[model samples]
Target: MKRDIQSFLLYLFGFLLLWEWLRPVEQLTKTNHIEMFIIFILLSFAVTFLRLRWIWRTILKLWFILFSLNQFHYQDGFFQLGWLSSLFGELTNNFGMIFAQNWAGLTNVFRTLLFFILLWLMVYLVRYWLLNRKRIFIFFFMTLIYITVLDTFTLYSANVAIVRTVIEGFAVMGMLTYFRILAKENVTSDSLITRKWMRPLVLMIVFSVIVGIISPKFAPIWPDPVPFLKAAADKGGEDKAGTGVGKVGYGADDSQLGGPFIGDDSVVFQSEAVEKNYWKVETKDHYTGKGWIPSGSTLLRFGGDEVIPVFPIHSRVETRDESAALHHFMDYTHLIYPAGIQRVQFERSYDLEMDSTKEKIIILGFDSTPIAPDSYTVQFKVPKYKASDLRQTSVVDLEQINTDFIRKYTQLPENLPERIKELAETITAGETNWFDKAKAVERHFSSSVFTYDQTNVAVPGENDDYVDQFLFETKIGYCDNFSTSMAVLLRSIGIPTRWVKGYTGGEFLKYSDDERQRPIYEVTNNNAHSWVEVYFPNQGWVPFEPTKGFTNNVSVDFTNEDGTPAAAETTAPVTPVPKKDLEENSSKSKESDTSFTFNGIWLSIITFLDQHWKWILLSFVMAGGAVGIMYRIRGKWIPYLYLVQFRLKKKDENIGKAYLVLLGQLERYGLKRKEDQTLRNYARYIDTFFASREMSKLTDRYEQYLYHQKLPEGSWMESRELWENLIKKTIA
Candidate 1:
């Protein structure tokens, strides 16, 4: 009984160790209702522990899984089969996706089932190791590695988890080791001996865990590797190579483009604006194919009261004056201003520097060093464009206005692929004016053909043009890909376009105490994004969002059939803040609820798959390997199970069933029962190994049962004790 208690404790700790792995899934990834997975795991362990028949255990687990799924999708009726049709439809589509290697296309239900299967397999492995091998160190070690990796790379804080895992893991290993020793030495089970071994083992685990907890932890001697790995992957010119997508903040390098990046939720600044608007840091006129680079720069210094000249409002376009106050969370020297930015207001005397060619503004301190002010107010104009005015404005007007400006903004790398130009020309063949041509190219990237992805993005090779690869080959990437490709495609078609870098208007936190102005908005590193600004001599630079699932909210009036401007101008939808923040914000408001529901679920599935699909697939692979091992090592362990199972039997029918079990154990133990050998002959060969005649005695009655199909009434009691003795001796 004491041994049973200790073994249960060991299994309990193993379950706790596995629980540490699931704890971070919901908080760290986009996976929802992780509590369902937790409940499933607990049930799996419970069913296994009851030592029920395999068929019964499988049935219970299956029903519980269906119950959980019903809660998620069939809430209209308790445990309804309403989901079966949906399940079959999604399953067929997903099977096609798997065949095509489109892992991301898998639905949420498929991912959920895959995750449950993974947990089920893992729990089974833990049970096997604990009961058969009396060891769990491998799993414990793996749990440690898993926790540490997640804590380092993701937002999951494994500090408490690590502590709990360490205590649980060490305790499990110590107890399992004790069981292995007891079995190896053939020690007698006694209350005093069990207490003697267990107390010290418990104390050792407790002492080590306490020491580890209290030990002075030094600052991480090395920097975080996730950012380092990201920077290294983005080392070349995937814009702001040094500043690259390392931690998702604004980067300064635009020398190269392409590569994968992770999301960073760290806040960069907060702004109080009348409405959400795109904030620009700079524009790059030159595309090197790999990434953006600024062209020849001309500097202009001005005071707060001066009119800012970056993308000035043209005489043809209508505008309204608007101002925004920005309070930064980080010390960034560069200014992030909205379109038509006129000037900046500061409490202290300061100067603003503008690289007119790049349209980048910086705050200048007393020493002329670029310094970030804690707070500043920017005044800008918001243009309401007219269809008649913009559509009538042509490239002829732009070239006539400033050939130098046209030449500078329309620059593309000389080696840019010919196919890109062909594709761009094909996309915008019918559009005569720059605005229509730009719009034509913008509509080309639809969600049906392209996806907005951050981590799975590809880097352009030395011979590969970034825009060409994104447009023709991959068709999947984030803002950089969409914006750069748009800029390049427009330039290819002779429309002057420059790449613009900036932050999208951030999430709406809440209304301020006064609640008079717009809601408070907090922008994070994840908001760092890029878009295309097509230059029309009359309309200045107009921002366009070619990235699927995002909009720049550029207002444009369309012409009616009568050729007059439409009564009301159309404002594009709000910018979908690229990665994580948008998904989180959309879940709150009923106004946005319907619009964002699918996107929210899709983002969550993507996020979880992004970090963990490899593990889920691998769980099955490891499960296969475990099965092969179980098969090979069956002989070393199968007899003990038979010994335990038959020890409780009393039915007369158990005599024949128990005899067959004895034969199989003997065969597995290397005393193969020859086909020609009589039962008595096999029994005599078995008796030779352990100097026991009990097998012969059991076999004589076994022959009576095998031939007559019944045991002699009093002979059965004698045969049972002899059968138990011989089976034990064969294993011993």
Candidate 2:
């Protein structure tokens, strides 16, 4: 009876260990009502551990599941019997979705049901392992892997969890090993003997756990792999599916370019500027069908205050001297400058490396890395692109331009689909000049034709073109899609356009801070964006905003056919006005702009959400249903995986593992051996079923290795083939 009590206590403790797995489900994932999951686990243990009849156990589990479901969702009234019919209807619909291969269409109610089924299986597996197998190492190992993986991949810290799990896992594993020993020896369990064994085991677990907790570990030998993994997993210029929704930020790589990302409000910098403008970081001249890549750059090194020779002002475009100061709150070194930037001024002396082709600037300091300064000031030329100058650039007279310059900027991959080129031609059919052609392509991505989305964008496949995919199907994306599509579309028609990455004019905070003349703006990770810059002989590289709802804020002068600016169209800063009237008018205009901006933003958000339900549902289902499906189908998938995994392995250790996998496969194939049967007998039974002596021969080698672990080096090679042959026979 005492032995029975000990066994029961161990089983209960095992159930508690399983509870640790559920803790992360609540904390890490979107799963709610975790306390109810604990309650369900308790009821399951109560029914099974008491050795109740199978029918009674099933009936109680079903009752508790229904009661929990009602408690969780159907909070309409007492019992809420109405949900029963609704739940049934949802389940039917969800099952049809499953049959239709629409995994992303599964409902939350069905997801909850799948989770309940997962819990039921977990309880049954734990019970079976504890009683019949008398081993808990696999489940214990799995739990450790689960915790460590979550700790590494997610924000969950497993510091304390590691210690607790070590103590509890070791304790449970030791006790189970002791019980297995007694069972193997066919010895009756004695309370005093069990106490003697457990006392030392418990002491050993505690002592080892303490040592591990207090030990000074080595620093990590490798950097965290999560970022690289995310890069590969994200919709960037890589061979990966674009299903992930990463947080928006100033990412370094533009190679892999299409995927949805959530908004990040973390501040990257603060700026004080006369007027808000797009801050330029860098430009990429080459666009792989997948994403952007920088071509070879001629590095130009100079002092921080030295003038940058990029974007030389032509005779036609007008420019005004302007300066903006930025204070970075994040750890960053790259300078964010506006169009026609002349130079950056820093408090201390620093050298700079500027990429001629890419136009990326690096402030050099210690070890040749960019010098991360807290603040700097940039002087720039606020360009006023004249309407007549822009309209005069025709592609018909290409003999006047440099061939190398045209080839570099207007480069396209040879494999670029003809349809993409045809589409660009179609969009610009009515346009006369290069600027008009670019404008036509830009205006084509209106909100009616394309939706601005951060999450629903797709990464192009191995053979897919990024621009083609966005322009044809999945006409929903954020800046990357819109800008890249515009760039590619323009380039297809013999125009020079490049992709530019930088921050948009971020959210305005106050008119000024600490008596500064400029308005203070807070730029966040979400402000990181990209756009297209079309190069013209007279205007240099002109920036364009192709994404829906985004404006480039380019101040233009509607110059007449003859070089005269329109007096009525000139802005407040440029136009002459009475001083007092200017102040009052500017104040009222700012008020109107602020009000309209807020109202427009709120309305855009509402409209986007209303039109974007499919992606939202897919994301929601993927958050939980994917986990359930992975767990649910593991049994069916695992054996085939083992066959493939062991097939490539040449190590001798594969002998034992291969043999064990064979046993599992045989049992799963309805060839379960009796409890009293030895491996030799079971092997004989399997051989009889398959009409092959391979299993019996492999079992002899396996039993020999049990007594003496060292075997002939070639034993595994022979046993592996036999194991594969036998397991393959079981696959129906």
Candidate 3:
């Protein structure tokens, strides 16, 4: 009975592990995970009760494969049988073609098979440990290490479920060990030891559950620097490289610019500021026809004690000024700054360059090589732009332009099509002023002439101009395509412009009620954008919006001085803030409920104690009773325990202790010998009621031990062993 119970528990444990792998059962079945787990456990119990032969076990395993295939379509109810048959027929009919056509499906099938194989191996291992009880502790420790390693890499699950499963696994192993120990001994079952032994295991489970509930979720402070893991992360980061979730590649010579838009909503940073503003990461003057790259400059190194970088701006006033405190959740090397930043404050010092012309700050030498700051604050002056003011400004004169400045901003590929230049001229034909011309180009793109698309953007072929391809051929692309084309077209007409890359002003989240009481906004990769910055004669660089769905930070006034409303103009609406699915958020919260407040945890503990005080007190009383019973039995049991210990240590010197134990057993059953009886007479008397051959052997050995005066050196030891064996046989 004990062995059978142990076997059943082992099978249940294997099913539990298998269930973890099969999780998220709602995806596979309409049933909830808890219901599925219960059903699986019941199924395991039924399988164990079958007591199948080895061949039947193999057949059962084969049946499991069919059952799994069938269960995948089980949601169809009675129709699943027909669907399975059809699926099997399809597979058999076009085995080779199906393998070629559905390679991913085949891979999934193989992966499922491998998962089941691993589960079967775990069950086999448990069975082996149950039979070889001496090695069970070593296996238990190894299994624990294996499970811990698995939990480290895998996503966290419901804490209660995880803790419960882990504790149950250990408890099941301990129970098996106890049963195996009992099976090796011939003593009658004692409920006292069982009750005492279970108390600690139960207490362990209770404590573990409480700790799991109250533990904070684990997150690494810094990224893993291990080579293989880093490599894997780097590979995974490729798709997210240009996107906002991980890193935005500002230092790359040519950004890999085009791909299907995959949106990421993971908050990389949150900024507390007075109003929304563009957070610039970096800028590049040189466009390599493929992407942007920085013009190489000499390094400016700052010592460890140097001040943080700051850039001054003359165009934007310091009034209505504000500070942005950026809290980073992801590592970033390039510090993000808002436009018109006057001073920057961070924990560390770095060499800085203030480009007053571009209104940009460059970090040349950070005190620490890689600047992975958790948070920083920037004090910036917000731009106060009115369209009337921009309309009044004009372009810089040709002779006033320095040769280097003209060469840099007006630079274009020699192979650029004349049609692109003509297109720019045609678009701005009615506009004479440089500001109006820039506005015309911006308005032309922002209108329905070009469509905004992310997934349909084309990758230019070698020798093909990307701007030309976007303008004339596609007429539909994302922000990079629109911004690049606008910059290049404006430069072709002698209006100098530079392409800028950065994230959009993120959506306002909520207000923080700290000392500052500022608004917080979450910024992610999907907010990454590119736009054109047009350089005016004396006003320095000004930003323009060319994308269909974006509005740049340029403030526009449509009213005239006569107090009459200006004409209604159509403009792109602000981009919608990406929202998370409610179901998904709920599921995540349920799974990740690891964070526990002290008050909440203490309340739970108090509630649990209050509810279960009766059971707890009863357990304590039962434990005390078991201890008292053990004390009472010490006189009889202690000597037997000492004899067993002696036999274990000194194998050659039983000293008739085993025979005396056997005699005690028989005497308890009223088979005591008469005091005056001879050995032969005693044997004859026993033979009348029971078999006497075993009794005769016991008597001869006893006689030799007591009266043999001329015995050999080891004769008493040999007689003691023989007497012990015959006494056991007589008692049985």
Best by TM-score: 2
Which pairs, if any, clash in model 2? Answer: 236-256, 236-257, 237-255, 237-256, 237-257
Write candidate 1's Cα lDDT for 1-732 as tens digits. 775676578668878988898898887567888888888888888877767899999998888776766677554565466677777788799999999999989887788777888999999999899888887888889999999998886657889888898888878887777788888888877889878988998888788888988999898744344533454232322244443344455777877767666566678788888788888988888877778777787899987567787767787788888888899878788888999888788888888889987888888998999887889889988998876667876556643567787778778878888998899888988777777788778888864688676555676776888888888899877888888888888888778888888888888887766647567788887788889888777677788988776777677768665876553444555655554654344234436534433333433454465567789789989999999999888876786787677767666768888888888877877889876788878878878877878888888877777889876566656677787677666656
In terms of lDDT, the best-performing candidate is 2
- Per-residue C-alpha lDDT of model 2 across residues 412-439, encoded as one tens digit per residue: 9999999999999999998789987887
- The pairs that clash in candidate 3 are 244-525
Runs in model 3 deviating more than 4 A are: 1-256, 301-312, 315-319, 348-368, 393-395, 398-400, 557-732
TM-scores of the candidates in the order shown: 0.50, 0.50, 0.44
Supply every candidate's count of residue pairs whose N, Cα or C atoms clash at under 3 angstroms. Answer: 10, 5, 1
lDDT of 2 at 413: 95
lDDT of each: 0.77, 0.77, 0.59
Model 2 spans > 4 angstroms off:
1-133, 137-245, 366-368, 396-399, 513-516, 559-732
Model 3, 615-652: lDDT tens digits are 99999999999999987654445545544554454332
Q: lDDT, candidate 2, residue 369?
A: 78
